[model samples]
Target: MPTQNPRVNVVLDNFLYQNVRLLAEKDNVSLSAKVRDLLKEALEIQEDIALSAFAEKREKSWNDSETLTHDDVWS
Candidate 1:
């Protein structure tokens, strides 16, 4: 059964499809599952990049607020 509306549809070349099919079969999983897992991983990587950028911004703000040098250490 096919869904009326699929979330995604990609067309790969024969070589690419062959590799994906082989790996999916080796893992005993469907091609759809493999694609879904790849999509999930891509989303996670995007989130990680966003989070890293936000953390870097905060660290810069913190560093800018402190103007003490090593010579004035604990003063």
Candidate 2:
């Protein structure tokens, strides 16, 4: 933990903790740093899923993209 950032207490199942510890060792990073990095990535994936769902919901609303011409909007 960095002195600049406040720390929070966390509990994990022993098996889960062991696996995370192994990953930390493998990555040559402190367990806390590894956990923070993993959490950041998980958050990013969640945001991606949400954005993708919104895009998919709107994708078919467009009639034609490839063959679209300027007059499609004005005429």
Candidate 3:
């Protein structure tokens, strides 16, 4: 049978492979699933960090006098 989802092949060091295998066994999921889940989580965290940096940069350059009120935006 063929899988519908895309597949990724990765090469991990022995230590990392062992750790991921252990985690998969603990969670009762396949190694691929465990790696996929971890990748998703890591990407989310990276996105959050990037967003936070952007927000902080925006905050540093914020000007209240040049801002608009809620009515101004709606109307």
Better of 2 and 3 by TM-score: 3
The lDDT values for all models are: 0.87, 0.91, 0.98
After superposition, the stretches of candidate 3 with alpha carbons farther than 4 Å from their true spots are 71-75
lDDT by residue for model 3 (16-61), tens: 9999999999999999999999999999999999999999999999
**Candidate 2: C-alpha lDDT:** 0.91
Provide the lowest-lDDT 10-residue window in model 3. 2-11
Maximum-lDDT candidate: 3
Estimate the TM-score of every prediction. Answer: 0.67, 0.76, 0.85
Candidate 1 accuracy as TM-score = 0.67
Cα deviation of 12 in candidate 1 (Å)?
Answer: 1.3
Worst 10 residues of 1 by lDDT: 62-71
Order the numbered candidates by TM-score, best leading: 3, 2, 1
Q: Candidate 2, which ten residues in sequence have the lowest lDDT sum?
A: 60-69
Please give the RMSD to the true structure for each candidate, in Å.
Answer: 6.3, 4.1, 1.5
Candidate 2: where are CA atoms >4 Å away?
65-75
Best by TM-score: 3
Each prediction's number of clashing residue pairs: 0, 0, 0
Say what the RMSD of model 1 is.
6.3
